[model samples]
Target: MILITGATGHIGSVVLEQLLRKLPAHQLAALVRDEIKAAHLQAQGITIRVGDYRDPASLERAMQGISKVLLVSGGGDEDGLQQHYNVVDAAKKAGVRCLAYTSRALQNPATLTNQLMVRHFQTEDYIRASGLSYLLFRNILYMDTLPQFVGPQVFEKGIQLPAGQGRVAFALRRDMGEAIANVLADDSCQNRIFTFTGAATYSFTDVAQALSELSGRPVEYTPIEEQEFMSRLRAQGLPAVAVERITGFLTDIKNDQESTVTAELADWLGRPPTPLREGIKEIFKV
Candidate 1:
């Protein structure tokens, strides 16, 4: 059986849904922290094992009889890297035949040296050294998160970010989930690594123009200095950790670290990924 960790999370839930369409539920298993919370998965006839990445013993228990596993990246917690290491070590000791991980895609490694990206690359090295056959999907930033970055006042205050003319090839979470599930559903899996990105790249200016057209209101892109960006977010009552995370993303964009455009996602999906304007409409309902 194949087990998907973080089975109730945003990406995990979509992956499980797509997998069910391609394979029988009985052939699938889910690793959840709480059995009671995963009742929906059990109802679908999938085996549910209670486990967490932070607990190696629990992961060992959950990996029983599982041949393949999907190791979803941990949330950006302080101990996130350790949590990932625990999962990989446990899977190795449990004799899992193959392991898959969702990783980050970075074009300019020097420009994007944030803690989060560093953690992903370190995890990739650890997984490779574990001697397990692996599938590494290096994903671009999610288009779904644009709404969060823009905030609800975009129509009024417009878009104010540290990114200048840099562009990002942002793919949707659902499309990535579908592509990952398709790979696992096939019986002939192999060790491979691919970067999943949108067909095209877009800047914040392009996003503002698209939003204006869809919302029937004027929206402008006003670039700000990094220090000013921090001040504004803090003035809005955001905590220091949240402020740092947002700053890291915008800084990465400003340095053109996320400007790579790849066709792998479309190649895997057998169709073109969603366009910028079309995706904005779907997410913002504009």
Candidate 2:
């Protein structure tokens, strides 16, 4: 059976749903923190395995009889790497046929200095030495979350950020999830490194232009100083860790680290990924 960690989360939930369409529920399993909370998954005839990345014993139980696994990357807390280690170790011990991880998509991941990307490298290294066949999905930032970053009033207030002349190849989360689910079910595509990204890259200025075309009104993008942008985000009461993660990514984009476009996601889907304007329109309801 294939096991999906973070089964109730954004990516994992989509992967599970997509898998249900291709495979029987008997061939699927979900690793959840609380079975009570995942009662709906059980209702679909999916075997629910109670587990957490922080608990190696629970992960061990969750891996039993599981032939394949998708280890969805988690937060960048101090314990994050250890949590990944726990899952990898358990999968190794259980003798899983293959293990896959959702890692960062970068032109050069080793060059990224972000805390989250660094931890992903560490986890990837662990998975490599675990003697399990593995696939590393180096996924770019999801356009599914573009609205949260740009905000709801973007059309009126405009975009003011530290990113200047930088672009991101933002793929939809559901597209990535669909590719992963298809891979999980088909052994031929299970074990490979993939740089998952959208068909094209777009800058904040491009976003403004797209918004303008959709709304038939002037939309502006103003570049601001790093400290000022960070201070403004802090003033909004976001947590320090959240602020740090956001700043790190925006800095990468500013430095041209996130502009690389790739076709692997499209190759998996057998068609081009959704365009950025369509995603932006749906995200902002324009």
Candidate 3:
């Protein structure tokens, strides 16, 4: 049986949907922290296992008779490492054959987001050391990231970012989800690391232009210094750590550090990754 953690999340939900199209419902399970939130999935024939990463026994129970497990990274929490470690240990004890992990792109150990990346790296390492067949998917920035950050700005005034002229290889979350589903469905994808990204690269200015054309408004791109941007975000009641993490990501874009799009995603999905313009149109609908 194939099990998916974080099944209620954005990419995980999409992954589940795509997987259901290719695999039998009885062969699938979802490890969810909240049974109430996952009631709809249960109704759809998914075996819902109520468990949290913090509880290893619960994970062990959930992994019973599970063959493959997709481990989606959790959000920043005080016990993130402990929770992830518990899941890994439970998976090992449960004798899961194939393990898949979702990680971030451009995860250099020196960056501010390094802590988050380290957790993923650690999980990958543990899975490898467990002698289990594994696939590590280092994913690019989600296309929804733009709408999440820039949509409000566009609605209020315009898109403002510190990403100057640098381009990013951003993929839609659905594309990432589909890629993961493809990998999980293929028994041949063992002990592999797939770096997934969009089919094309785009800059912040290009994003602004797209928003302007779609919304029929003057969506300007304002490039600001990293410190100033962080200060503004902090003033808006964002945590200092969150501001630093987000600003570091923007700085990476500004430095041309995230512009790597490969054919690997398409090869896995048997289709091209979503284009930036098309993704924007889906979000804006104009």
Candidate 4:
């Protein structure tokens, strides 16, 4: 049996749908914190195990009889690392054969602003030391994040970036989720690390052009200093720390330090990953 944690989340929900196409609903289990939010999944015939990563006993109960466990990372929480460790420990105790983890792109331990990277590294280390077969999906920044950062302005004015002319190797979350499903279905993916990204690289200006074409209106791309961009977000009542974190990621992309997209994603999915224009159209439903 395959158990998917965070089954109600964006990537997790997509992954669950794709996996259901391959495995029977009876063979699949969804570990969710809230039974109310998981009514739809249960209605679809999946085994719903109510659990939270923060609770070790809950995780232990959820992993019962599961062959593979997909440990989706928790969102920005103070105990995120410890929570993940609890899942890993429970998976070990449950004798899960494979543990698939969702991680960030960069593996370098020195990247200061790479919060996800650091947490992933710590989780991976724990998983490795557990002597269980493991698969790591070090996913690139999502094209979906573009909507979060650019959507508000796209409807009013247009998209702006602190990235200037820099290109980012952004992947759609659905594509990443599909790749994860593929990995889970295949046993050959054991002890492998996949860096997933979209089929093509795109600059901020290129994205703006795509939006302009889709909406049939002029969308402008303005490049400003990172500090200036943070100031703008601050003026809009965004929290100071949140603004800094977002802008810092933009700074990493602008420096061309995060433009590398490995071919593993396309190979695993057996097709070209989604392109930026197509992703944007899907997001805007245009």
Each candidate's TM vs. the true structure? 0.97, 0.95, 0.94, 0.94
Cα displacement (angstroms), candidate 2, residue 37, comes to 2.2
Q: Is candidate 2 or candidate 4 better by lDDT?
A: 2
Give one digit per residue, the lDDT tens place, for model 3 in 187-267: 774599999988888998888888778877777888878778888898989997788777767777777666877899999
lDDT of each: 0.90, 0.87, 0.83, 0.85
Candidate 1 Cα deviation (angstroms), residue 122? 0.4
Per candidate, the number of residue pairs that clash is 0, 0, 0, 0
lDDT of 4 by residue, 1-286 (tens): 8999999999999999999998889988999999999999999999999999999999999898999999998886778899999999999988888998998775354764645447778898998999999998889889988888675768567777787777778888998999899889775645988888766678888888998899888888888887788888899898866787788777777766567778988998899888889988998776
Which model scores highest in TM-score? Answer: 1
Q: Candidate 4 overall Cα lDDT vs. reference?
A: 0.85
Compute the lDDT of residue 136 as modeled in candidate 1. Answer: 94
Candidate that beats the other on TM-score, 1 or 3, i.e. the better one: 1
Better of 1 and 2 by TM-score: 1
Task: Give the worst 10-residue stretch by lDDT in candidate 3.
Answer: 107-116
Poorest 10 consecutive residues by lDDT, candidate 2: 106-115
Encode model 1's per-residue lDDT on 1-286: one tens digit a residue. 8999999999999999999999999999999998898999999999999998889999999998988999999988999999999999999989998899999888866557365788888898999999998999899999999988888888889999999988999889999999999888877557899789999999999999999999999999999999999998999999999899889888888887888788899988999998899999999999
